[model samples]
Target: MKTTKRLDLAIQKLYTAFHNNTLNPECCKQCAVGNILDHTDAWKHLSDNHGSTTLNYIGMVNQKFGKTFNGYSPLELLHIEAQFLKACGYQLPLHHNNKKPKNPTDKEVLFLGLSAVVQFLCKLDNMPDVMDCNQLFQFQPQIKTSKALMLS
Candidate 1:
């Protein structure tokens, strides 16, 4: 299957699970295919605290595709999502710290992340860049983290 199609299917599965309250760790493992958590605390928090099913799915996707998911906290996942989004040409509104805000509410962050992934895939396919924020959007982009940030 095409990568985009696969991503869409995964997202749909996640949403179905969430709406049905079937987002337990076991369910996630079966549906998300590389989710790291053994239980549904992350999903629970995502539902109760964050508002976007898309963000929850992004977390699941990162666990599956990004090797960093094993020991990551939820906040870390948000940061990774932000970095991923920025790489795809979304000019993230900077927080007061001149960085993307930490631990964004799921509603505030999920669509941006999903859009980023779509954008990245478009870049991979050599499509014309559609994002309007950064010049880097025109090229094959990489997520960049400073050494200090990485060490923190």
Candidate 2:
């Protein structure tokens, strides 16, 4: 399936960050949205607190002016970060004392975070989730059920 140019770029950057061990849920400049915006922490100014979906004054102004950073609105960026953090086993808002993965750089942990961000990105673009494997399972049951029904 064809993806938007922005989405494709975001995915590429995320893939690079993941492989480079730079994807960190607790770091603004290395999180999902940050990586998508080319490793910039400027997106953090869009929200009053990290991991928050609510946009602050600056974010509201940007939203009012129809501004998008790397093709993502301020609100969308915030949501993406929240999704990544949650999938990475971080407590929302990213407190130092919050529960987090034992190995923050673990491939499994990063994969989960990336999966969530990709899923959310797809949703924003009104596309089917690339990370979804339900279709693989869906066909299996249909074939088995049809054969079982025929035998019955």
Candidate 3:
């Protein structure tokens, strides 16, 4: 399968799992992947309790990919957040502390997971640049739009 198709499949799987409540956040909570996915919502990154867990995922991804993120700079965290925002179809704010809209839809969560998977695949495939890594998003298919969902 093409990389885009493969990644899209993974995103769909994640979407199903999330809607089915099949993913256990416990699996990645302390690790970087877990920190971002398991912890935050659409609007926020730094939890007063969690305090910007992006660094954790950075170290983990770097370790897994044999790349180094150095984990200490706020700029590095912003960079990762940029990728995630793109994947989530969100816009980057001028202020790092600004929050996004609350009550993220299932699609949002899955796309976020897709973002992480893309990062992981990039590491695994040794294709780290944005142009290369972004191909993972070429086939991103939304299972359902908000209009189809019954909002309470």
How well does each candidate superpose onto the true structure, as a TM-score? 0.27, 0.86, 0.31
- Candidate 1 lDDT, 61-143, residue by residue in tens: 55557533344444443443344445323344332434442543243343454445445434544553344345544454566
Candidate 2: tens digits of C-alpha lDDT, residues 1-152: 78888888998999999999888877788989889999899999998889889999999999899999999888889999999989989887877888888988789999999999999998899887877787645543344677788998
lDDT of 3: 0.42
**Which segments of model 3 are wrong by more than 4 Å?**
1-32, 35-82, 89-99, 112-120, 127-152
Q: Which candidate do you rate higher for lDDT, 1 or 2?
A: 2
Root-mean-square deviation of each candidate, in angstroms? Answer: 14.2, 3.9, 11.6
Candidate-wise lDDT, in order:
0.40, 0.88, 0.42
Instruction: Tell me how far the alpha carbon of residue 42 in candidate 3 is from the true structure, in angstroms, after superposition.
Output: 20
In angstroms, give how far residue 34 of model 1 lies from its true place.
Answer: 7.2
Q: Name the lDDT of candidate 1.
A: 0.40
Which model is ahead, 1 or 3, in terms of lDDT?
Answer: 3
Q: After superposition, how far is residue 44 of candidate 2 from its true place, in Å?
A: 0.5
Which wins on TM-score, candidate 1 or candidate 2?
Answer: 2
Model 2 accuracy (lDDT, Cα): 0.88
